[model samples]
Target: MFSSALSVLALASLCAGVLAQTYTIFFDNKCGRGTPTLVDQNGAVLSTGGAYNFNGSIIGASAFLQTGSCGPSGENCCTLKINDDGAGPECTKSVGTNNCPAEKCSASGGNLVIIFCD
Candidate 1:
């Protein structure tokens, strides 16, 4: 019985590891315009939604999933890196100005919503 319980515990640990995946997002503030790109550790696009807009332009400015402003219709599930190229507004409003310091992780139906924010 002890051996059987140990085997079950081992299997549970293995399954738990397989269930969790870590993704990262980087915030670029060098450019006034904060461009968020999502990629996997292997750098892949999980969402058809484009680039997300981090609010520098307007308050109601939404965090789109892709290149333009999109609603929930926008949240492309990709790891993001911020390129701080001097442009539009000012990306630095907080510490996550260059990296996804604020990581948002959500688990749903074996899928995860990992959000990176500057």
Candidate 2:
């Protein structure tokens, strides 16, 4: 009975791990000569470039962007929402003079690309 219980526990643990989902946020800063900031939904600066991966559970969580070498108080920041539907890999300038368009998320993918600038 002990052996069987251990097996069940192990299976449960494995299942939990398998059920957990992770999503990646790809940041493309093409603003020419400025460093971009990526902020999480809780107003935390998660990263400043390239990419960031987060737990898939934060479905509606958003990441805000600050372009240029504006440090933390920069202007022209944009917002990108976290989605796990694999629908996007899109771009949108939430708040900026930059002319980037909003892209839709993919339906079966976990990769989202946010483009700043061109």
lDDT of 2: 0.54
TM-score for candidate 2, please give it.
0.64
Model 1: residues with Cα > 4 Å off, grouped in runs:
32-118
Clashes of each: 17, 10
- Model 1 over residues 2-86: C-alpha lDDT tens digits? 9999999999999887754433222333323334444332434423324333322221122223434422322432222233221
* Per-model CA lDDT versus the true structure: 0.36, 0.54
* Distance from true location, Cα of 28 in model 2, Å: 1.1
What is candidate 2's lDDT per residue for 1-118, written digit by digit as tens? 9999999999999998887666677766655544545654555677777677765344444544443434353334445555444333333324543533342333237566665554
Candidate 2: which pairs clash? 86-106, 86-107, 86-109, 87-105, 87-106, 87-107, 88-104, 88-105, 88-106, 91-103
